[model samples]
Target: MTEQTSLWQDETQSADFAELCSALYEREIAQLANADIQSPQVIQGRLKSLPYYIKRTAHLMLQTQTPLDLDVQNASWSAKQAAHMPLSGQEIAEVNKWYLAQTLTHGLVVPVATTTHIVLDSIDRIDQQNHRFRTNVHGWFYLNDTEQKDKKVNANYRLLKPNKRVMTAACTGHCWVNDHKTNPVIPSLRELLLSCAINWRNFKQPVIF
Candidate 1:
């Protein structure tokens, strides 16, 4: 007797995923009331420089056509953008289309002892290293893409890893990944990125939010 494999392996699972992602995006947007925590409209108004600002801040812009948040980058992209060159919307959509169309299970939990966390509208990434295990932890909180060319694409990225250690002081253009020769050399490197989107209802009137 032949047994059937998972639908994801059959392609239907991936198709379902695209639909699921679209639905999730909508659910996030639909909950946006002016009084809601994650109001889409309020987020759009608070737009600022893209990329870094997008990462360190809890700002998420609402889109009219699609459920995706606005592709945000600074008025100017940081050096990383010029070197690595982040993704654009069309590119992302294409990826999402492929990803959502697939069925795969990634990291899962089995109810072991886990760290507790709080939700902060403003978050910070600090680099701490020791002889044993070096970690960039997203404490109290932990947690996308967008387009344009005039500046670097409105990439939403975080301090994936600590940049200070990478030290761009003597580099070609103050770029960590690209400039520093020593940066190219590292041991057991683990880079993690995190972001947060504030509930508009919480800090609506504030200039910062």
Candidate 2:
């Protein structure tokens, strides 16, 4: 008796998935080519100029409305046994989608621009009478631009300590919090794009800028 082949072992489906990935990659590269990060207008628009190919791909998946049966534990076990018992095509696709979402949401990081400035909200201040005040005034503490190595510099133009209490710069044109306790890091353009893509994918809807 001949053994029946599993859907996961079908070469056609695997080829199709590879083609889909290639097409998406090409589309993303094309969109990125058109975006000039150094342009003042692009920076002013924040991450609006960047293309969200991941979200767009997710939207296409939503159109299929395919119910996914993703068992995390089972998936992990299947991955471990992949060389012996392979997962189905659907399972592979679901795993890839989940991984893509995870990567876009958390794993990716980009370099900060050298010209970017770190503006902090001054919480403590000194009065005109030489008396230091604990007033939680919402003042601005503009730090110098990052050094050649992307290190944060203080008002004295020195490397800032990690535990220093200061308002750190956020994405351009985005509102920042004045929390005096935790140090904030600026979000890169790719980070912003990834966030938007992830949110759109989760909501299964278009995100308006």
Candidate 3:
């Protein structure tokens, strides 16, 4: 194993992992906010509010993971679904961080040109009408253990409260064979964040039920 791999394995149960997650989150958020900001003032405000956004994202993830009266906002059909997940609480924290990082990164750019257009349009609308334009990332993950050997993980991201929670953008997701221990696909926090933002848009509009 390489030195970096050894370090990753060693830090799986260490504070270093948590710190790495935090750092990665900050970097990802900064990149997203910088890329989408409408003005310098907006960028300044986003930078100032970074901690709040990060904290809110972390809290939401924690809340979703916790069972409330045996109900989770996002849950797999069986505990077996999470079998591939580590049982360690500390490690779970790191995993959650990783998930959130990827989710946020992907959430911002899933719809490609549409995402940017929407953000810019919202900014224009806000400036023109002095109204609030809210957009957020929401999605779920399911562990795939089908007969097929590949695509062991599935995740999607959609616009939150697409229409006052009465409607939402259709989810866009992809499958991956995640085996970080060997031939790690996400070797570093940078890669983890970078992977979240794809060069292409792979999404469809929300379908109202």
Candidate 4:
């Protein structure tokens, strides 16, 4: 395992994982506010806020995991504590989507799109003015065991696979995936929508209810 890999990783189940995601995300809101995050800032502010979000989420997800040995690393640190369980991949993805939603809030549905899905569970808005996409779409959700799988060029950046080995974004998703943030926070409704923006737009949309 890479140094980045958690020794005490989260293997928690779906419900617990969901709760943990919510809690950590709530904590993240405070951290961002304390950092004075307002809109229109560069991506750096978002990036800077990440570790706290990821680490906190990670801690919740992997309850068996203790925090870093800050003294050994010479990092001024928070006190050590433990939770009842470990986080799981679902939780990680949940929180990850939360962060992603926050990042991708308002986008003009680009034209030349391949699929027609328009909304996921938490869609915020469809910028009617800017969307040049050819097809009209409704929304879509995971119908069953819920999976996505495909392959793509590093260039376009749309993830083609839902359950690929790395499951996060391609290219390590430095901006997107922070395995470090493995905890109990679920993405805010908006964040969750935004994170799954593509699915919201492509897989979920184009439906008629």
For each candidate, the alpha-carbon lDDT, in order, equals 0.24, 0.29, 0.28, 0.31
Least lDDT summed over 10 consecutive residues: which range in candidate 2?
Answer: 76-85
Each candidate structure's TM-score, on Cα atoms with residue i matched to residue i, is 0.19, 0.22, 0.26, 0.23
The superposed Cα distance between candidate 4 and the true structure at residue 53, in angstroms, equals 16
Question: 1 or 4, which is superior by TM-score?
Answer: 4
User: Candidate 1 lDDT, tens digit per residue, 98-194?
Assistant: 3233231221000101111111122232222210111233221111122212224213232121121121111111223333222221101011111
**Higher-scoring candidate on lDDT, 1 or 4:** 4
lDDT per residue as tens, model 4, 71-113: 2111112222222111234342453353334323334221111
State residue 55's C-alpha deviation in candidate 3, in Å: 1.0
lDDT of 2: 0.29
TM-score for predicted model 3 compared with the true structure: 0.26
What TM-score does model 2 achieve against the real structure?
Answer: 0.22
Candidate 2 lDDT over residue span 12-48, tens digit each: 4455444544544555456556776677676545445
Model 1 quality (TM-score): 0.19
Clashes of 4: 39
**Tens digit of lDDT per residue, candidate 3, span 1-209?**
69999898666534433453475465556566558566888777866875665544333333322211211122110111121212233232343333233323212322211221111001111111211222222222211223113523222222221211011111111112341212111112222222223222221221111
Model 3 residue 7 lDDT score: 92
